[model samples]
Target: MDEMPFCVHDVLNRPLFQRAIVLAGAQGIYREVRWVHILEIIHAAPYVSKHDLILTTGLWLKRSAKSGLEYMRQIIEHQTAGLCIEFGTTVDEIPDQIIDLCDSYDFPLILFRQPVRFEEITQDIHAHIINQHFGLLKKLEQFSQQQQQLILQSTDIPAILRLLQSYSEHQILYLSRIEANTYFPPLPEEMREAINTFCNQQMKHSDQIQEMELWKMDEHRYVLIQPVVCFGQVFSYVGMLLHQAHPTEYMKLLVDYTSKAVATVLLRTQFLEEKILSNQNELIQDILNRSIDSEEQAQMRMGLPSPNGEKYIFVGGIIEFEHNVIEAGPERMESRNQDVLVLIRSLLKRDRMHHVLMMKNNQIYLLCAKARIGKDSESSLYHKIQGLIDGLNKYINQAWPHFHFHIGFGKSRTMLLDAWMSFKEAFQVIELSQTVPAMKQNHYYASIGVYQLLHAVPYPILSDFVQDQLGDLIAYENKHHLHLIDTLAMYFKCMGSKGETAKRLFIHRQTLYNRLDKISDILGEDYFQPQRRHCLEMAMLGYPLIESYHADQ
Candidate 1:
């Protein structure tokens, strides 16, 4: 959809101005000319726009010697395309000062030795501009029609993208969560990976569609990043790589239409897949809802491919999109959940993971089974699950920056009917993710450590326990604005080594001794006795809970 750029050189090529001679500033003949205008005002800066070719018989310059120089300065400063002068009637020959000024600025100056009609020149150049624009619009219409036909012919996402390469004549990069990423006409593996990394970067403001530079391209080129959004969520991206200096309105329209066409194909494909998988989906629902007590029935309902008498090892996990998603509103939240369901299924399918996925209470709940021991090992299964969470979390968080993820994987179970225990463990893991930073790295219940013991305790008792153990020390620090509690923690961290504790606290050993003495007076020296010291350490681990309790108060 590119139209030829009309410039001063093209205008002078016309037969109407055949006798025109270049008087000065011949170097800027290539300057663009969008329209032709007659200069009637002395201060023409306000009326003249860039790309305008000013035409005159030099009457304005004949007003006074000073007026001539001033008028030319306004034309150059306003960046008008050029000036055409007719050496007859009002003014005969031009002043040398004006010609020299035009030459210095490289402002194109043309002169007609014979009288020429300004009307003919304006109409002739204007007709060419109008014709080129009309052709561009017609080409855009044809491209749109072809894409619509491609959608009807096949539901393949790549089929839609192929049109982008053929028509727009640029390398096309289509990144989809639902489909394998494609490079139409294909790029080298390394370049494609580099471009993929470049495109996947999170934009500070994702809603603004713009051009991006392609890394490692020998020639200067750009990639127009256009997102494919459906149901208010972006699930894929379609980008065009070319040498355009900036994103043209034509390029924007082309990418926009192409993205929508791809979206339509993806939506239809998803609908058909959902229809085929509806029964299996219901089986997963029944397992999570505890409506089905028999693993045999679940196997039969989902049509499991496992051999006769073979028991499947099942693992359950919950991927929690924090409670704040509810603030986005109920209907919108529902749509968002459905979109996530699509994303998770796509990701699981991409990793060849055996999973039954669902969105409940704005969180993702899935049960994956190991049907083949050699094909998908336990470690491989965990790797796949972690990859699924990381990929989905990265993608969705980019679209909704405020959204965060907390994931928990349950212990593997021997039967689908007992899979609910695994799910519960996963929920505990999700809870741990909020209070335990170590839990961020450890997603399983087996690695939860002491948090498993504290998980079932009520919030009031936990907070009360922390305060009871450290109450006097906390009170002292608050009253004196001192970090005696920090000193105490560091002292414990250094294992009763006075010098190490002082070094860690950035205080002298005597200062550490003074703080320890104050603690000795406040809580009694037996606070470091084996049994009492253990309680104080656990209280320190639970310190944030009490801090949160105080904040809420």
Candidate 2:
């Protein structure tokens, strides 16, 4: 429970109010009281704020000829704490209708049969109200200090939430999208799932939301949802249920302080986890840099299984990021990395793949190991890894499109020490992905077919090779704005089937024939001969890679 509110019940127990008689609306004696307001004006509802205790001699009602019931009605409409009337001095008398109205609305009405000094009453009550607020502030300060000490001593989320529960005395909920969800006082499993599903839908529909608000969970429940922010990102939310009561101002303050404490705990825990990950990544980096020389040294450095009975084949892979599309600060990038890291781990676990994943600056690397199953072991793992990347692309594109990236895999190695060779092959695959859009679908280095042979050739030689066969045709097509090259390439792709080429190009056969004639005149009819056909086909394949590379620059 929040600090017990100073209510009308407390005020009635004061020495000065001891002689006051309880009229109707006695059941509302617990209404919260903030301060005392003495008003003798008509339309007093606009002058007095909510939770104020009104002290008056009924002067407005007597002078303005307003009904006693109407005056009390205005007090109730303003939501004042209660009404205390000095009965005899202002020619006043209590009306049954006024008492009935107060009773119906649960608005408190207190009567003083004798004349009383209004100034003394205001002074006595105002001091108590101010002192109560000061006491609450001091208590909140102490709670904050204790929370910090507990966080410093241990990065335990549940313990901190439990402490908040002790003060708020409400059901606590900590929901996280990147981490595990935690709740206090225990919740049903189905209820947890329902809440998670609802939250996911809300986030997908619109993630932009206020930091703290009263969210209605169902028809009967409302919760004060406070997003726990760490390093400028909200990865999780922590809230306290409001039961059936509306949250008070001080209660809102309590929730804010507690959320800050939770954020501190999350950041601290992430800091510690990051330290461990950094050390592990250092080992992976050393391997990539070829600093580790021996199999035993590599295994020990990464804490991998020793040279025992089960032989593990190691392969390297990379998820290379595109830098041109994003402009984010280091902190925002780190937060994005954390989110991607969690999703990647979940994928690895689902595939039951043993791996050591490393997150470097612009790329994520995974050194995976599987039991050797004859010569097909590597091939089997290659397909599985391909499927994993495909799944991730499909899932993350819909969920986190900004995480767009290219993927590449290397050949499997028998020894852990040879992991560096795998990484080198992965770099080769990444190079191909940048130049050849077709290579994006073929993640494995072996799947590049003829490109693997061309990879050995120098870049200048490859460019010269393509130009020597197709340079005149390229210039002719560019100058005339013709589709001769496309028609010819599709003809090659369709294996000289003019009908299929025309259909694929969405053109008539006559149009394709005309383009092909132009292509023949620029190059020569002998270009389709066995030797020249081979050269022309190779040039067609290399032309796209060169074109895409230049476009990227």
Best-fitting candidate, scored by TM-score = 2
Model 2 clashing residue pairs (backbone): none
Q: Give the runs in model 2 whose Cα sits over 4 Å from its true position.
A: 2-32, 41-47, 65-146, 205-210, 249-254, 273-281, 303-315, 319-415, 439-450, 457-472, 495-500, 522-536, 546-553
lDDT score for candidate 1 against the true structure: 0.78
Q: What is the RMSD, in Å, between candidate 1 and the native fold over all Cα?
A: 6.6
Candidate 2 lDDT at 48 equals 88
Query: How do all models score by TM-score?
Result: 0.68, 0.73
* lDDT for each residue of candidate 2 in 276-383, tens digit (9 for 90 to 100): 777768877888787876777677665565554337788888888765434766766766676667567656656677777789887888888777858888777776
Give one digit per residue, the lDDT tens place, for model 1 in 106-185.
99999987788889988988898888668768978998898888888888777778877887777888875455668988
Task: Indicate the residue-level lDDT of 80 in model 2.
Answer: 88
The per-model lDDT (C-alpha) reads: 0.78, 0.78
Clashes of 2: 0
